[model samples]
Target: MNLKFTPLACLLAPLLTACGAGESDETPIAIPAYTLTVNLPQTGTLCVDSNQNDSCDAGELEVSGPAGARQLQSQAPGLLTSPLLFIPGDPAALILMHPAARQDGQHLTPSLLSSLLQSRIAEGTPPHQALSELLAALAPLQPNQELASLHRLQEFNLALGELIMAVLTQNGAVPAPPAASSQTRVWPGLFILLPELSRHFANGGDLLDLQARLEAILLQQQPRALVTASGVSTYSDGTDYLLTDEPADHPGQDASLKQQPLRYRKLDSQGQPLPDNASQWDCVEDLNTGLIWEKKLDDASSPRDLHRVFAWEFGPYRPTQDELDYACPNSEAICTTQQYRQWLNQQQLCGIGHWRLPHAQELMSLQHYGSLHQQGGQTATLDVRYFPDLGAGANGFDGYYWSQTLTPSRRLESVPLAVITPIFWGSDAGTDYPTAVQTPSDVNALQLRLVGEVTR
Candidate 1:
């Protein structure tokens, strides 16, 4: 059977729309309620006779409960609260209940819980309370292997918190509660505490210290039950939990290194450097490098500084002259642009896995403090000059670079221009600017920069 899961965003979209208007105020709106019911079909009789006689019975017979054979009857609709249910010989079902229905003696559904989570987070509900309730809901679902599941729950909680914080911060509000101490109260009720703990630390709290405490507790004693990261003062198990100090390394570093050198080299397959026509350099080269190089220069000229020259001269690395043959195959080559694009569409990269042009938001996320500039020829608020390797070779010096991601508002069917700010190696600041290149066709190029996070 195919399992279906709804994105948390979609499930909460309605609630989000409703609360969006009143979000400016500190007060949370009262949650609305609704009721939901589920009904199961009756089992056929032939199956019951076979169970009773231990043989293939052709005629129908009444099947009973654990005690004895009895008549089977259809069951009335029953209130459902859990997001998942496993009924013997029945397909699982999900029921969604609203707050108003719950108040009228109805139980909450998993979807309802998800909705509440989104709503409360939007309303800037205190993290402690939000986390507590989340934990209470998840506690009953704990699996036999507690540690791994606990870690996953923690990660999920952290991701949710981060998303909420980002939304709140974008809307010009404080993401966290005023009372820092109140965080302690939030942990006991939560099913997953690690993510919340991580969020607390990420938002400027002592998370490493807390992690150490948790490690110590886990090592000393193995607790039969999962404990929230927040209230990890003692362990139920006699063994102490200790956190391993080794940091998790990223797999992207190798890919980044492999691609970095390509930024500097010139010449197509024949060992011929790029022609000086400058005007012809627009979008004719390899989609990824060509786009990068095109965005780096206004019109090719002498290096304004080391930065421009470096970025311009360094990339499109060549392994052998033959390797360049397929670099940017156009109609003139055996593999046309359409063929290359189709091939690219088949490949996947980054955590998103599928490599495609990025949307405008995904592209802009690379922007750092280095991309800022000042008005009227004065130094910009942020300077890219601080970065060390931005424009060092063939790559252009200082200009906006485009990302593959398109803008959010653009229709998925209609490809839009996408770009990012150039990295200024001269200043040591690695900043990316958000920008896009307009395209007549819906077709867009796919370019990706590899980045990874180190989690302990």
Candidate 2:
């Protein structure tokens, strides 16, 4: 998706020579030529108005579908550059654009198109000035301000584009755009749910009215665990998560899902809950499940270091000698899962004395499948905001945390518990995103995240 840009200064130059009032000039005015080369992820048709006419005539140059750079020339005389119309088949139906960026050979994505439209430009504005305004408008939309992956952002653009295209082609009318919300992170939700909502109402409702109705519906509903949404809003067979209400009204909620994204509350070292927006915390409470989870630290010397690994066994389980050596080094505390649970209880983590290893299903509850879709693959499967330092650790451990659910060992007489591992490397699209399998009880290379029942 490379887009080659030329100096907009020359394109913005006046197309006519100054002449005296009432002076008749018969000379034909020469139109300045402008070249644009667009690189696409896949072969797509591109059209630019090569003539002063507002339409792409048959005689005008059009680039054929090819998954690479496609160049076109435009000589339209105007302050506003002709819209670069593209038809990228499938996922991307139609991408309308103008020279809203000044970079040379930059990859073109729906995100780029989104930023351009965010400028809310007035008609007849010069290309260079529009580019400047676009950048300024895009400053607050960065990932830090509005959490979104590149893939999700592109998906959003495509979804919105197709919806608009369908309305114009099928309904023969263009609905007015919805008013922008004060929240900067609403685009993902808008992109994921707005289309379906429009279709749900037969595409006749005003976008603003629909948005208000949907918001009211969401406000009245509570977050349900089984009905929890993964934030995926597209291509679900008869089951769309976006339409469901999962209690997403709280501030600082993770922007990962469109419906009811995961909600978590942080806790201080003394087991006291902290503010929702607190940047530092020692524990996390899943608002939906009412379970508090241990927060691992990045420091190697800390007992809760994310890199720490342990061995497990059933019926009077104990840590392996290597684990004891690494974990308890020069300390009198025993270094086993049972001992760790007892230690946390003694400390009353989050003011709870029942800290224990989570069951397989409880651990699975933390898995967010939308991560695979939003991030594509080979990324952390949990919300880093609540569970940072997840995924692979030192020496390439698969981040399989030991769970309490036991499975009979085939060869060994002792039963080994199942360990759940979130695929951090890659995914078969998401079919195998949740990897839970039985492992040898004596295996000394596994991680652990303790969880406790929410009694308070």
Candidate 3:
């Protein structure tokens, strides 16, 4: 392998006594520094580890984007620690590494996982070549070795996730490192239970039986099943689990990353901060996005009650009598989404006057896709802790939340559509994936969640 070590210039002339070279025949040899170019997936951070802590420190050479050059100061083979780590934009993205095998002009890609490839290099195969062989070897393993291959793959992913936790923690990110006890339960659960799953499958184990066992381990482990991607915190309900979109590193050339969970701060009616554990709050501020969201109330007397649904008054069609009855059950004057926004602004709900319907993307950001899994008959798509007032609609699923965006299709001008996202699913009902849907702006009785810009 070609090594790209750059030569260091001599500090002083050997003939000059002032340089301290005349007193000794020996001269200090400078350690060679290697540079590598990292190509990220449109977004992510790259850190060249100088301290070997595996995290990007304040003064470390760090870059972010699709591509950048980082200088690796340590030339030592990365037997134990990664010399370079590329953290992708997604919080759950598998941390890719420039394996320990130092090579010149090594074009490092995001698909490289340090541990497995490094292990191969320890056996004397070059990493680039080893990567190729490993990819080829991963293709459809023999029946006898299938279980073993799976176990190995899981181990590598877990090890890589541990490294990611270290990086996140060192950077003061939210995810805490998994405790040693968690690691203990996680590994043995995988090793012991996987074979059982395979055998059970071989013996005609039903899908529900396998699911129950897998769910049990996921629950019994509490957190860090070692299979769940890092960065996302465990939900109060163990049924909510986020499966990483990360492809097997050995076979896939590129994969999407799991993003860090969005941080939120609760606010009271006066726009004052509340403790995260606070049982009551009128609004939630997305710390990552700097957007504040309105919290629906449980009381029907309040205009912001979760049960009240409204039609978009600004649409081409007017609300039908049934729509008005559902939105303003007690014949409240404000029966439409526009009227609700006006009332909220007039009252300056949560001490913010600019509250308006959120864009579709902004509203969808609150959705927790992991909640799609069927568990305990709970089917809300958002974290109930932060957004406690989302209620089942007349149709029995979590009600739809209206967005300001209109649909792009060229339907009849009189039937213009507005975007809405389903916030809940009925047990044994609803689509497999929760996403935004377009409905008749004036006819659909959708709920509204307002968002506002941060006031600095």
- Top candidate, metric TM-score: 3
lDDT score, candidate 1, position 168? 25
Residues 91-194 of candidate 3: C-alpha lDDT, one tens digit per residue: 54445544542444544543323434433433233345655554444443223232123223443344435533443354556754333232332332343344
Q: Write the per-residue lDDT of candidate 1 for residues 309-384, one digit (tens) a residue.
A: 1110011211222222322223122122223223333432111122233222332332332233443333322222
Q: Whole-model Cα lDDT per candidate?
A: 0.29, 0.49, 0.52
State the local distance difference test value for candidate 1: 0.29
TM-scores of the models, in the order given? 0.22, 0.39, 0.41
- Output the lDDT of residue 422, model 1: 36
The number of clashing residue pairs in model 2 is: 6
- Which pairs of residues clash in candidate 2, taking residues 3 or more apart in a chain or in different chains? 1-107, 1-108, 3-106, 43-66, 43-67, 271-350
Clashes of 1: 83
Give the Å error, residue 364, model 1.
3.8
Q: How do these models rank on TM-score, best leading?
A: 3, 2, 1
